[model samples]
Target: MGKKFFEESELIINADGSIFHLHIKPEQLAHKIILVGDPGRVSLVASHFNEIESEVESREFRSITGRYNNKRITVTSTGIGCDNIDIVMNEIDALANIDFNSRQEKENFTELEIVRIGTCGGLQPHTPIGTYICSEKSIGFDGLLNFYAGRNAVCDLKLERALLNHLGWSGNMCAPAPYAINSDKELADRISGNDMIKGITVACGGFFGPQGRQLRLPLADPNQNEKIESFRYDGMCITNFEMESSALAGLARLMGHKATTVCMVIANRYAKEANTGYKNKIDDLITKVLDRI
Candidate 1:
């Protein structure tokens, strides 16, 4: 056989049939996807997959595609933040779209459903830690896609302007913050009763200093997290705080795909979530969500 083009190869796969970062090929991926930020969590996710099929590991991205409820789904790691999410999300889409021989888009594309099974600090205290919460809405405090659309279009113009005014926010940066996007209904229904808490709010952090966190230095806004929780628009409170949900939601909607997230509350702004070591507890949550998802 002669040399193959990019589409002929999984870019992520080797001619020797070794997997790339995820180290798995087309057969390893399922129509449904589950994403986590940590590589270690990938094993936790894969442990739940039924009818063990295949596995791959590259860099921080660990992936396993197998059967769950007889449904084929791929579980992988996104590393961290929107940049990583953007990369993994696109690659997964490409795997299903392109011919794996030529890099060209397929004549008929498949819109794979994705669910981010990660951990986050929830703004709503009622959202207890260890609970698997789904993100019906996502708001980026990180400002990733701030320039993509009109500021007044998605959310309340009055609130945005009001917050700006109250903060005395004058701008060299007047770009619009990303808006909320709901997850896939079909997928959501499938996993609805599966140890999952639906309707979570995801917060994207601008950085350490601003997300109500101070390490060696002082913080810019001590009450920022509270402000996020305090604001209730249309009874939809910011459910949880993370770095990628809003961007994922918005981008998924724009791409004509359905995306949703179920996150474990690593920390709750309010003193409600059972006080336990963050790491191990989050592990339990991830397992629960994946089994149900």
Candidate 2:
């Protein structure tokens, strides 16, 4: 078969053969990547590295590769939302599996172990502030996955239908049809510790209206949080609300990579509790994830 060609517009690469958005080459990355929402958190995670190898930043995406406990790992900041995930995941996959010179896919695929460490808001009252939670399943309110073909093949249709029915969603409550995807079982098991809470996580598109936070503008569904909190399907309930996990897990699965999310609870919506002093808790969570990963 003839080698496939990618147009410059389609597969954009710098003159140095690095990916356009990330501004990083394949060699600068590790097989295991820790994705954070805040760029500053990249440095926080890399601070524990025994030896720092490389650090690169472009826009909101900051990547640092180093060795920790004799294990090579890369920590990259993905900004926020599935929009950034769309870019970051595709570029990371390209760097690992595509040859920039020929603009062709490699014969052998490189599977990545991606773990997202971020802050989240607990939806259930029982989930206390400063608690750590690992997502067994991520439900996305964003439509990024729907844009891609074969998304249904990767999603949990039964769970998705149940949630949709529970919400009474008829294309008016939200724009995108919600879908659920499970985390990599091995990574989930490895990342979950005795203290970590495991449950379904809802990835909202926005921080305010989408997450049921009231501001100057009225929300389309003010009871959104209540509905999400009360939603249960076959013993699975939504435990927390975050912005990125769904796309991360979904895209990782579609790209043949293993992925999971471990988040620190900074706020509890049901209890109306917010922790202003959670830095130390985050530090401890980071340490725990680093040790396990």
Position 172, candidate 1: lDDT: 28
Count of backbone collisions within predicted model 1: 16
Per-residue CA lDDT of candidate 2, range 1-293, in tens? 88778789999999887899999998998998999999999999999999999999999999999999988999999998989988999999999998888888988989999999999999887688987899999999997788888899999999988887777786665456987999999899999967899999999999988999998999887887898899988887899999999999999988999999999999999998888787666878888888988
Candidate 2 global lDDT: 0.90
Candidate 1: deviation at residue 102, Å? 2.6
In candidate 1, how many Å is residue 182 off?
2.9
* Highest TM-score model number: 2
Model 1 TM-score relative to the real fold? 0.78
TM-score, per-candidate, Cα-based: 0.78, 0.97
Model 2, position 247: C-alpha lDDT score: 95
Q: Model 1, which residues run further than 4 Å from truth?
A: 1-24, 146-178, 189-197, 272-292
Once model 2 is optimally superposed onto the true structure by TM-score, how far is the C-alpha of residue 172 displaced, in angstroms?
A: 3.6
The TM-score that candidate 2 achieves is 0.97
Candidate 1 displacement at residue 194 in angstroms: 8.6
